[model samples]
Target: MTALRIALLGAESTGKSTLAQALHETLPVLTGLRVARVDEYLREWCDREGRTPRADEQRAIVEEQERRADALAVGHDVLIADTTGLMPALYSEYLFADTSLAAPAHHAHRRYHLSLLMATDLPWVADGMRDGPHAQAPVDRLLRRWLREGGHAFVVVQGQGPQRLEQALNAITPLLKDRAAALPPTSPSTVGKPASGGLFSRLLDRQARLPGSTRWTCELCDDPACEHALKSALPPATPRVP
Candidate 1:
């Protein structure tokens, strides 16, 4: 199975690390597969160096983020990344007026199946490494712009702590089921092709054609939203009962 790589992203202190860990721990139990994680390398760099990265260091940060995420994805059903290179690249541009490191970050962003954008609505907490409390808003804007312009499928995670975790799980349900359906035993005879609306909709269309396909995708059907989204995404002729 192609591991589902989900990025928890946004400005600093938006709980990307917290949510990444939560999902990393919870998802495996839900999917019955090992879940792995790659956290923010730039923060590790900053902690080690005792200072924010210089322009020259930005490339290394972005590159390392990609390398770390790719490395952990092996032999796992899912890889939860705290942040992609896009964070450092976005920060480089927003904080240091640097753009050179962004291209590679954009490339890495494409590798993620979904990005859970941490909403900047929560109260900002100071972690000595963050630029300043005021820095989050503008950076949040840039992150949203990047996701939008990049055409990546993303959902903003709101609420606090556990509520936030639940939202992330909700957003990922379709993907988890899709990944399950994609595992071995799947063949040209059972798989479906792309259709309208989006990836989820297309997958549902294909899923409708195969017997027992619902068994693969319905593991998370207890959640009304997941159940409804799956059925709604399917073609009208194949309306599935939850």
Candidate 2:
């Protein structure tokens, strides 16, 4: 079966790496299935070269990130991308005033079954690779704008640590269930099991659905004002398995 693709997107120090690593580790335990992760290629490039990529070097970074993700997707039940080519593409635009990477980056992003946008609610820390806290807001605005313009659906991941992982799992579990339902059971033993893929079936069966009215749509979700208003009106999300 084709792996479910999960793309994690966020500005610098917004916890993309932390959340991605959590999902990569937790998902396999929650679902008795294989999980693979493709880390941010740009991070490695920076560490190796001791500097960030130049405008001329952005395209290679985007291509390499996509290539690694594609390579990892085979034979895995899930693929979690720490970040996607959207980063380099957006950075290209934000830093170099170049818009050329947008189309290919969006094309790559569309393949993911789910996208999680890490909220900037966490405190930012200085890192050698980071552009600093000052860059987060503008970069975030650009990312939201990109998603809106592309008409892609993405859930915003909020909260801290385990709470954040739980939020992402809540968004992801439905897709897991849908995929399970679509496939035919190949064994009698597997026939009556919960669609959760394995162990945490009981917990997943009771996972809370996102509270929303019929009026909710991807377009509105990308809008910060609309999302905030809706989330503010809803009750707190149910806590996931501890």
TM-score of 2: 0.84
lDDT of 1 by residue, 138-240 (tens): 8877877777677776666666787677667666767777776676543331244333342244334444553442222343322223423543332111111
> Which candidate tops TM-score?
2
Clashing pairs in 2: none
Top of the candidates by lDDT = 2
Show model 2 residue runs off by greater than 4 Å.
184-200, 206-242
TM-score per candidate, chains pooled: 0.75, 0.84
> Where does model 1 exceed 4 Å of error?
185-242
* Pairs in steric clash, model 1: none
Judge candidate 2 at residue 132 and give its lDDT: 88
Candidate 2: lDDT of 5?
93
Q: Write down the worst ten-residue block by lDDT for model 2.
A: 233-242
